[model samples]
Structure formats: structure tokens, C-alpha cells
Target: MFFADNLKFLRTRKEKSQTAMAEELELKRTSLIGYEKGVQPTFGVVMKLADYFKVSIDALLRYDLSKLGKFELSQIEQGFDVDITGKKLRLLVTTTDTNGEENIEMIRHQAQAGYTQGYNDPEYIESLPKFQLPFLSRNKTYRCFQIKGDSMPPLSDGSWVTASFIQDWNTIKNGTPCVVITKEDGIVFKLVYNQIKENQEIMLVSSNRSYAPYNVSIDDLAEVWKFETYNAFEV
Candidate 1:
């Protein structure tokens, strides 16, 4: 099914108003209206809708659309494998302009510590809940850093967030927060948006009600990482 048709069908099956879906997706109702009216949902936005409807992108776009319901989709969306072995840590990072292909710059543990110390003297790494490195190869790079500021309160405190970097922005849906690195500031995590300008003035948004929105030019950005999860060792 076409994206719009799929969207319309899913909403009806769930018996949800466009306003309700928009609110649940954290989007303006107008945007959802546009989507149903044949406006192409951005890659990010499509993911959000798929997540809300609880279906995979393939299921949303190409699968037997008639067989799925919102509740079933929600389960599929939320179902994730917990790495009990703790060998792999899922870290989200943003993309670089490497000719449209994605690239990530590795920030080592010691370098990460430098950025962390700049924010506070908390032994951020050691204090984190310990999980075995989930791999036999010690040389494999698993941890990555995200620079944070007061913008995202309570969850992030302007410190570098360490996680494994995975480059799959297209699959990453909109309204999901990510860590973007700019030339001026090493890295900042915020919601991804499509507001682009001639000079690449991309909007860096926040989901937290207390925070305000801001714009960042492409010249300002060094990298962007889609955040997966965080490792905050209990203090």
C-alpha cells in the first residue's frame, strides 16, 4: 500500500482520530492531516507512525496491510532483545556528510573522560552499572560519546553520553531524540526535524516540555547520532 493509504487504513483500524494519533506521535495535528491527505511523511516521521502503530517499516509499506492492528504493531515495535550477556551496548549517533553515506568518528574511553570531567567530577564511567563487554575482541569499538547541555533536563545533564554507534538514520524515525555534533559544540542530543534551509539550518528540537527549540546550521554540525539507550550507573 502507498504510505498515505497505509496511514489512513491504520488509523481507522485503531479507531483513533487524526488528532489523537498526532498527539500520541507528538506531532501537530496539521502534519498528520497532511500525511493522510497525501503529504509524504519524512523518513523520521514515518518511523514514528510505524512505531505508534506498532508495525515494521516493511509491514507498514509492503506487507498484508489487512491483517495488522495497532495493538499488534505496538508489540512488534516495543519488542527488543535484551543483551543479558551485556556484550553489546546499543549507542545512537548521527550522520556525517561523507558524500551522503553515513560515518561516525570514534571517541575513545580516555577522550570521553575528558569531556565528562569538563561537565562534572563524577566518575561517570566507573559509576555506570557494569556489563561485560559482550565480545571476544577487545579491539572492537563499542562505546561512543554524546555531548549534552541543559537543553535536555533530568535525563541528560550536558555531559557526554557513552554508547555504541550504529549508523541507520533512515530507519530512525522522527520525534526520536538524537545526538548531533556541531563544530562549535562537540555534540548535543535533540529531536531530529526536517526544517532545513539553504545554509542547512536544521532544527534541533527537544521533547521535554521545559526546553525550547533552536536551529543549527550544517556548518555547525560535525555529526548526528540517533540515541538508542543510556548507561547511567546508579550513584
Candidate 2:
């Protein structure tokens, strides 16, 4: 179902003609056309397409790859298939300890810039400092980010805020405190006002009254994490 649309989108995004791409994949132009027109592909042919696109067979078939942003697409092209479902989706690259328990990666002020680009890279994620919180749920993924500036008061600057990954942006409630990772803004801690249904954007508001709220299109969003708790620094 999604495969046909996803195939057409990917091909168009690559700006390749049916004949050209078919030739590159050693597939007949007609076969490629049929595949784009909803005809089922054989497992071997599926494998070929997967290899050509640098995506997983499961993602190529099950996920709507076209709906993802460029950052997310690049991640998929690198063979990191996102497990989340829905229209707006992004991969959550994480590392596990020797016991196979998930580790919480810390993204400090120094690592914020690289995190935006390397968020989907497993190696990059694994390289970050990691630890686990006993109180946090084991089933969910968590990441700690060091907050900076006076934008958020109670949390204070240089404090570490550990948040859980939010797979569905639609589930984000209005005025919810979250860590939003965007293309334009590397990582921001804000009170999110979900406007996804009406405008395909979410309004980011600062806890401090001095800072004005701004809108960020969902297209610019790479990841969203619901605020769990923070470890405030001594003032």
C-alpha cells in the first residue's frame, strides 16, 4: 500500500526517470512502472530495490518513507529504519549496555551541534556519554540534554533535563514542556503548543515571560522529547 507511493516519491526525489532508474537497478522499465502503479514486487525484486535505495525491506514496504523529512530520509538511506509509525516520523538512534538494557545518552551544550546531524547515526549515539536512571521506565527511550540560558527559569542554565522520546507528535498536549530537536534550532527546551492539526506547525514558548513564542513547521522537526524531570544545578 505505502510501497507504491513511497517508491514513486523516492524516485521523484532522486529525479530519476523510470527507464534510467530501472536500468540502474537492472529492472525492466515496465516492471518498475508496474511497481509504482501498485503491482506487487517479488521478494528478490524487493531486495534489489531496497539495496538500490539503501533502505530496509521492512521500511520500504511498511513505512511511508515519503512523509519523512530530509534528515529522516538520510537516516533511512543509511539503513537505520525508524520504528515509529504515522505521518511525521523520525528514527531514535540509541545504544544498549552489555546487559542489553537501554542507556540514556547525555547531550551537553558542547555536543548539541553535532547531535542535530548525528541523531540518527548509531555510532555517533554510541559515542556519547551514557547512563541509566532507575526511576525511568525501561520500555521507553530517554535522553538527557543540558539546558542553557534563562529561557526556562526553574530548570536553570547548565541543568540536565532527562526526557523521554515522543514517537507521535500528535500526542503532544498543549503547553507541554518538551525538548524539540529541529533543523533550524539544534535543540531547544520549551513549552510546546501543538498546532500540528491546523497548521502543520508547533508553537514553541519559553517559560520566561521575556522570550516570545515562535512557530516551527513540523517539516523542520527532527525529534521531540517530553520533559520528564531535571537535575537543577546549585545556584
Candidate 3:
């Protein structure tokens, strides 16, 4: 079986270290190292790896996917070009409260620059200020962003916008307001126009007519939070 080699190849191809991958998958680093060294994994473990890597069990265990070309591997994976688009399985790094419920971390205006750098850092996420809303449904993850500028009207600068985390971009509806986190722009509140299917891009339209609409490529998107409500007053 090519499982051992395949595991190592897939992890490295994603540019993730064994320790990071293990933590993301909730596995021990030593165990992941052993798996790469040819220790047979349980059926459950194999299934988890396959799902995380977005590969079929048959291909992961039987085929040497590392030997395949980018186009060929993309064909096997299906959907978007996973190799170049950076649209892999995104494991959201978050923090929880004492009762084990998810906490809504606030990304303050001053911390926006730092957030872009430490977005994936668990410690950084945990360090942010967090709170909960009684009205919000517990099933979905929520985040609060301190938005700036007059791009999103009615809600002025420094207003707090609480949003529900959207895992799949395909589920977003056209003209829906959202808090879009991107590689180029840290975070911005805009009306989203879905274009992922046709162009692998989304057009972000600002409510304020002064600012022009812009296109954000899928490769640049870090996170998308559906707009729930906002606090017009300063928090």
C-alpha cells in the first residue's frame, strides 16, 4: 500500500508540518510520524486522513498520488484546482469558553493588522477578547468584527458587527451582507455577489456609493462570515 508515502506527500504538499497536521487532525505527532514510517493505521484513522486530504481511500492507500501531475491530481480531487487555488480543507482555529461552548472573538480595529498575520494561530485567537450573545444560536460559530470607514452605511466606523461563520462559500446568497476576510484586505463589511462557480471570484459591493465594488479571488479568501446584526453604538 502507498498509504505511508501518500500520507507524507500529502502533508508536505500542503506545506504543513507533521506537528501542525497532527494537531489539525487531532492526532498525536508521534503517531503521525509512525504512520509515515509505515505503521498501519486503524480504519477510522485512514478514513479521517482521506477526508482531510480530500482523497478517496482507494487512491490514498493504493495509488502513488505524489507521482501524478498537477492537472491529473486535480482531476482526481475534482471541484476547484486544489493545488494552485489554495482552497484546501480549512481547519478553523478557534477558542472555547469554560463550559466548552464556542466563544465569539472580537477583532478590534487596532488588531486588524495583527489578525491577518495570526489568523491561524490558536494562541493568538485565544488571546482575543470574547463574549457570547444569548440570542445567537449555539449551533453556529460566531465572530465579532469592529468595522471601520463609511463603506458599509448606517453602521458607522467603529461599530461592532457580529456574524455567523460560513464554512462553505457556495451556500452564500447573492447580495447578502458579510464580513469578508482576505489576504489582501484584512477584513471588510460588504454586500457579497457570488461568482465562485463561473470565475472563482466574488464581487464585493460596498453599500456606500462612494466606494467602488471589487473582485476577490477564491485564492485570496481566508474566511467569510454572514452578517447577522450590528451595534451602531460603540461597544
Candidate 4:
């Protein structure tokens, strides 16, 4: 149900014609139209689309989203800039250990896939690797997440990024190093271009020029975390 909506949404958002998008997806124009008209694609095609769009399968088919109580019709109708000034803006869950040390949630490469569904789940947070950083004792929530690819090297792959959760998205400065959790791209650590005023979207810039910059909607954000430092993954 939502797959059709999401597919069409991505196609139009990128300003690509139906034939062009179909060819890109290796789908015939008529097949693409049928898919848009609510025909379910094969598993392979679904995975291909998910990879092509850099979104989770769940995001592509968040079927019957109204039942989840996360989306509202009025929000779309008004078309505001997704003002998250004082909202909860859920991210990694944290807790104080027995010794009063705040446990920082650490999401590694293996957990990245599950994070799409479990980022807000308390049980999932409990299941992830957690540790305490002595210097990060400020009155701010912090979490550690691993980046998997070379899009932002010399950071390299599997680097653990410890970052502070940003509650007010508007305060994000352009060119700031941050980890953005999105509906489509999942978790991406990149230089953020704050374009809320001009486009109501954030542009993610990869340090590696081989990977081009792309735009993400503020509405599709799960959370934003300002980077601090990172630990290299053990080989």
C-alpha cells in the first residue's frame, strides 16, 4: 500500500520521469505504472528499490501508517517546516548504571539494519552495546553509533561516533558534522547543510566526492545528533 506511495513520492521528489525512473529501476514503463497502481513488486525488485533509495524496507512500506499514530493528516495539509523545537524527538535510549554512570547506547554496523525499527524501542536499546564515557558527564544525552561505509573517509568504515542528541533541529548550523537518522537513508553521518529556511530540507554532504550530496526532508527525520569524536573499530 505505502510502497506505491513511497515509490511515487521518491520518483517525483527526484524530478525524474516515469520512463526514466523505470529504466533506472530496470522495470518496464508499464510495469512501473502497475507498481504505482498498487501491484506488489518481487522481493528482488523491492530490495533493489530499497538500496537504490538508501531507505529501509520498512520505510518503503510503512503500510497503514495512520494506525501507528506517528503521522497526522493535518501536519501534511498545513505543510509546515516540521517545527521540532520542543518535541520529544526520540533518539537512543539511555539509563544510569548502578554506579550512577549514564550508559551511552552504542549502535554498531550489525545493529544498523535493526535500528530502522528499534531506534525508539526501550527493549532494543537495552539489547545494544552500552558503555560510559567519563568526560561525557555534561547534562546532555549522548549515544555512540558506527558508520559502515567509506562515504566519509579518513573516518573509514566501522568508526564509532559518539554524539549528543540535538533536540531543536533548527539550531543545527550549516556544515556541522552530525549524524542524521532519516526514514529513507537510516543513519548517515555527514556534514549537514541547514536549509530549513529555503527548502525545509537538510542536505547531507559526503567528504568522499564519489558519493554525491542528497536532500532529506525534515519531516522524515528520526533524530539529529551532533558529533563529538569516535573510536576506531578493531580489525
lDDT of each: 0.54, 0.86, 0.85, 0.76
The digit string of per-residue lDDT tens for model 3 on 39-82 reads 99999999999889888787788767786656547655663333
How much lDDT does candidate 4 score? 0.76
Give the winner by TM-score: 3
Clashing pairs in 4: 55-184
Error of 2 at 116 (Å): 0.5
Which ten-residue region of model 1 has the weakest summed lDDT?
Answer: 81-90
Task: Give residue 8's lDDT in candidate 1 (0 to 100).
Answer: 87
Candidate 2 lDDT by residue in tens digits, 5-69:
98999899889999999999988999999999999999899888888888998888887876666
TM-score of 2: 0.64
* Residue 148 in candidate 3, Cα distance off native in Å: 0.7
Q: What's the true lDDT of residue 51 in model 2?
A: 87
Better of 2 and 3 by TM-score: 3
lDDT of 1 by residue, 1-235 (tens): 5678778887987899988888888899999889888888789998888777777786566544444344334444465321211123323223333354333233433454444333222343333333333332333223345444466755655344544432432233557667665556555677777333222355777767677788775445444555645555432
Q: Total clashing residue pairs per candidate?
A: 15, 0, 0, 1
Residue 25 deviation, candidate 4, in Å? 55
TM-score for all predictions?
A: 0.36, 0.64, 0.65, 0.63
